[model samples]
Target: MELSRRIKSLPRYLFAELDRKKQALRQQGRELIDLSIGDPDLPTPQGIIDKMSEEIRDPRNHRYPDYEGLLEFREAVASWYWRRFGVSLDPSTEVMALIGSKEGIAHLPLAFVDPGDYVFVPDPGYPVYRASTILSGGIPYTLPLREERGFLPDLRDVPSEVAARAKVLFLNYPNNPTGATATREFFREAVAFAREYDLIVCHDAAYSELYFESPPPSFLSVEGAKDVGVEFHSLSKTFRMTGWRIGFVVGNAAVLSGLGRVKTNVDSGVFNAIQRTSIWVLQGNMDGEVEGWRQELRRRRDVMVEGLRSLGFKVEPPKATFYLWLKVPEGYTSRDFAERLLEAGVVVTPGVGFGEWGEGYVRMALTVTEGQLREALRRLREVKL
Candidate 1:
């Protein structure tokens, strides 16, 4: 059978070749220090696990969950947003559950974009933004995030004609490949732009809770943002709940209604047990536990940043997130630099894998331990660029 046209139009998997090489090395008994993906190495807090254990045994939870999520979970989210961001949310009207932020982000284009419509998406962004737009038969209009601009997209750069047809604008901060954060002023600007173009603003704030310095502001916290967009957040990064597959979207009740409609038809809601456990995590007195994670992550970040800088690699210690975006050594492309690291039995994501504008940089995740980072540093020192 032939693949559908949309499936065939998807971009090639850039890491497939790198993955094959890794497997070959593994077969040869070579040890590799992989620092590619941004999965947290920390375990889900014991409190969350214990809470889930209790919820899973409830007979009622075995039934399919409410499509909009349990009212209690949504209330907890509303409360948490108020406490953490000073942002008030109407649980019944504005908040809805997601299997994960990725699921919601992937389905959003389906609800708003028509064939050949434009979606203003950040380049070097989470691949889901571009992939989902394409899958929905929408054109992805690139919003280039260059280093000179602190990696924030310049909204004014979009042609007026392109903006006129754009149906959505996707943003992420602290960003994925680049560890850049956006200011409230920038978010205000985004809101105005969305209003002018009549676009749905999709803000992926999955990394907001993983900050090292000041807490990152939510797009919804900006005045009038709720008039134009919604923000997607996940328990994955903050609670080490990546495998739990639970998250939520808030703001613009009308936009959330569209996403909820798509979700109801496409798949069942998040498991009730998981949702209840997430509520426990959100409502519990767990600030100390989360602070502990931040401490560990900060230590790991320092070790990696210091080690890379000593080796003459141009990298900044990110103020948020566990990723370090490094400029590849001169005369070598991002793929070449990553491949060289692989030869040294170390793995880093080539920035080009994110998008065309990501070339000349490599992303290193701090999910590995300090000891592994030290060992990787030693290996990196021997690689000739």
Candidate 2:
């Protein structure tokens, strides 16, 4: 049996590879302290859960839901965007529900990118961005995101030829792997670049609500961003609803419609009960919930930063997202360092898992309890990286 050429070219998924190693270690009776994935250990708010429970009992909700989503949920997302970012959207056309932001990010290329068309992807980006592009038979132009440039790819640095064939550009901030957040000015420039190049901009704002000091900026906040851009938002990070698989894509009507068409062919819709719960999560004033999570994350961030520093590693407390992007110590690759940490009972993601440019660093997610975090730090300090 022959496999598809496109599928053959793709690398094994980062987390899947990590899971294989983790499971092997765990099977050996090693108590693995997993900090590799960015999954929140916090519980979902009770209000949202209660709403889901009530909706689940309704016989009507058991039927197939609309592919676009429930009108109430769409309207709630629109209203949330308007109130949170002051970006007005037409719920009827500009908003489409997704199983999760990852679904949208992975399936979107099928809607807009033709085979052989070029996509500008960050070198140290979330792997799905590049994998999706490859799976669609589209060429991915990796723009190296270097520390000197604040982990952002400079559009001006893109070669003229690559820019000419580029149809889509992917941006994420409060970035994964490297928790670098983009400023409004940078986003404005990106919007302008997309407009000038006649490219579609896909902004993955999954970590928008996980900020520490200032709220992360939405792509829609920039002037005319909606003209050439679509942004993906997820309830996973914001409302601790990772398992719910609810998220939204907001922007140009044409792009939303195209994505909706792709979705209709592949998936029916997210569960109605999840949609109703999402409506409650978005519309209600969950200020207390947000504040509580932020404070706890802040304390964890300080401890991890200080602990890593004491081990003679340079680590900056990320301004947003619960990840620590630490540079690999001398003479060790990111993969090797990660393996060493795992052997010492700590599980962290290797930078090389994200991209080649990410090879010199490692990402540690602060998704464990304070005591567990301290214990991981102690074990890390003993490891000879």
Candidate 3:
């Protein structure tokens, strides 16, 4: 009756820890303003819902689906990539639908990582990146994201030996926790680095649709990007379809073939009905609706950032993503500051929970109403830290 080493190795999951604190506060009968996890509070679009409801009525969707995905769904994914990023993908060979971007991300390492192999991962990154490496018995080499560097990983700092030993390099933009976006030049540099090292590049572009000012650029938009990497896009954030759990990976045919092989062995693909609905979502022109979402998010971001600044906390409005990364005041650790805020009835994620490099900051997701955000700011006014 021994627990597996893999399970034992994991620290408490980020959101779970926040939930525990929240429950403790609730038991104490405290009114709480939670801004912790990035789960959007927005409603899914009517068009997507209507499509799903229609599909669900047909018994054809009740059966098991193709392990790779429906061809039409893959085709829709290809079309979206072309329209959004100007990147062309062959649906037959280059696209594999995912249960969600998180599923694809967690399972990708298992496809390629060998026991004891090294992976180039960003510290202060999505927890699943490091967790997946560890679950696959691979070592995660930390690439710290510092604010002065615009929170981008410094690929040059990687030792040649590490690069030679690494099997994959995982990147994300607009990044979660950090809310930093990568540029075309940075993605080009990344592709060159991956080429030199002969490794897989897993680019998570889940937040690409939630940009504030302009649409975020896709890694595949960079020249030769598809030669060395795969880009993961989500239907979740883009269309407020988080619970729908549909996304797709596109790029190098060989890389996708391996990932698809792994997926086929693991489980059946996303529900056929869901895939049909996703096709509907992708086929439609989403700019107007998505732009409305961006404008609302921008409004919320301004409220949160401006309020934090007025409270004497230094922070900048993020250009992409729905997160606001705030530096902890002098003499306060990330957890300490976050804990103080929790005690004061405001819940936010501690940056240190992201990784060692995140020691001096906290992350607040703008997934709440403007009134709730304003109220959270009012709650924060109690903490002098």
The lDDT per prediction is 0.93, 0.89, 0.89
Cα lDDT tens digits for candidate 1, 300-367: 88998888889987788898888999999889999988989998999999999999999999999989
TM-score per candidate, chains pooled: 0.99, 0.96, 0.97
True-vs-predicted CA distance for residue 297, candidate 1, Å: 0.9
Give per-residue CA lDDT, model 3, range 69-98, as digits (tens). 899999998998898789898999999999
Q: Number of clashing pairs, model 3?
A: 0
Instruction: List where candidate 1 sits over 4 angstroms from the true fold.
Output: none
Worst 10 residues of 2 by lDDT: 11-20
Between prediction 1 and prediction 3, the one with superior lDDT is 1
Number of clashes recorded per candidate = 0, 0, 0
Please report how far candidate 3 places residue 130 from its true position, in Å: 0.6
Model 2, residue 359: displacement in angstroms?
Answer: 0.6
